[model samples]
Target: MMISALPPGLPHPPQETERLKSAAEQLETSFLAQMLKSAGVGEMPEGFGGGIGEEQFASFLRREQAREMAQVGGIGLAQSLFEAMRERHDV
Candidate 1:
């Protein structure tokens, strides 16, 4: 099998916050934001997964937003922000 090389400075997965941030910035991708949205992953109430009765989910989002903001000096936008850093940097 032939090996395929990746682009310079682009790891399969980010290895640090700075790297991830830089990649997102350079590629105009919102990986961090998308990841943040995914981490709040949870199933909605039965029969309401795709229904209009997502009040509980909405409430959860609100609380999560407040917590994130408070943690990041009002700039924390998503749990993924912190989670990504922790994962990439092991910090």
Candidate 2:
């Protein structure tokens, strides 16, 4: 006999629903962060810059900005992702 993790015909609990939503939002944030990084949104100046520490933390700034954007329903990608995932998993 095999033990199933989700089992059949059982809907996910509220925490699981929240997890799916969070996952979708995270994906959107990650995509936006990458785009911002590629666009040099946080790039330091050639001179008179914050130097190495700023370089290390620049990505964090982009990520937080991206998270804020996603929270504001950025590009509507997160909502679409959440719906698709919920439907696919029969949640």
Candidate 3:
């Protein structure tokens, strides 16, 4: 959530722009996490420490992984979202 300072004389984005960017990134993360979950990327194999607890917490791991992936430019969804919002808002 650390936004870099805009260069001097550049117009700063409104507060709503920051909120939109954050929301867009979060949406992308959620989408990616769900996709990873659907693909069973982190499911523990049977008899390999797999259990109800693991199952219960699998989504959490997937979410964290997805967040990292998004941060590292996974699928470019966040960038696309940000660009689209910027255009829509003329910011």
Candidate 4:
């Protein structure tokens, strides 16, 4: 997360914009993960499924999937969020 100041003639550093985009994407990922949870995305069926370990780790799997989805242009939420935040970033 180190952001060094750009040399004299250079415009705003791309790093800051990249950081903001990453943050927005992560936010989208979290939102998708929550929605998936509410939709029983990773829910194990029956009482004798993969046991407690599977239950505990299913969330991690769902979140990873959500992150990948966001990275691959999912639902357009991340892009919209990034554009709005970028306005504030340039302010």
Q: How far is candidate 3 from the true structure (C-alpha RMSD, Å)?
A: 6.0
State the lDDT at 36 in candidate 4. Answer: 86
Q: For each candidate, give its TM-score against the true structure.
A: 0.25, 0.79, 0.72, 0.80
Give me the overall lDDT of model 2: 0.87
lDDT for each residue of candidate 2 in 1-91, tens digit (9 for 90 to 100): 4322465467778887898899999999999999999999989778868978998799889999999999999889999999898777763
Off by over 4 Å in 3: 1-14
lDDT tens digits by residue: candidate 3, 6-84: 5545655678578777878898899999999999988987779767788879989999999998878889898899878
What's model 2's lDDT at 34? 92
The lDDT leader among the candidates is 2
Clashing pairs in 3: none
Q: Is candidate 1 or candidate 3 better by TM-score?
A: 3
- Candidate 2: where are CA atoms >4 Å away? 1-12
The models' CA-based lDDT, in order, is 0.47, 0.87, 0.81, 0.84
Go through the candidates in order and give the clash count of each.
0, 0, 0, 0
Per-residue alpha-carbon lDDT of candidate 4 for residues 6-64, written as tens digits (9 for 90 to 100): 56444566777788789999999999999888989988888759988997799999999
Instruction: Say which candidate scores most in TM-score.
Output: 4
Better of 2 and 3 by lDDT: 2
Ranked candidates, highest TM-score first: 4, 2, 3, 1
Instruction: Give the residue spans of candidate 1 off by over 4 A.
Output: 1-52, 75-91
What is the number of residue pairs that collide in model 1? 0
Question: In candidate 1, residue 35 scores what lDDT?
Answer: 47
In candidate 4, which residue ranges exceed 4 Å CA deviation? 1-11
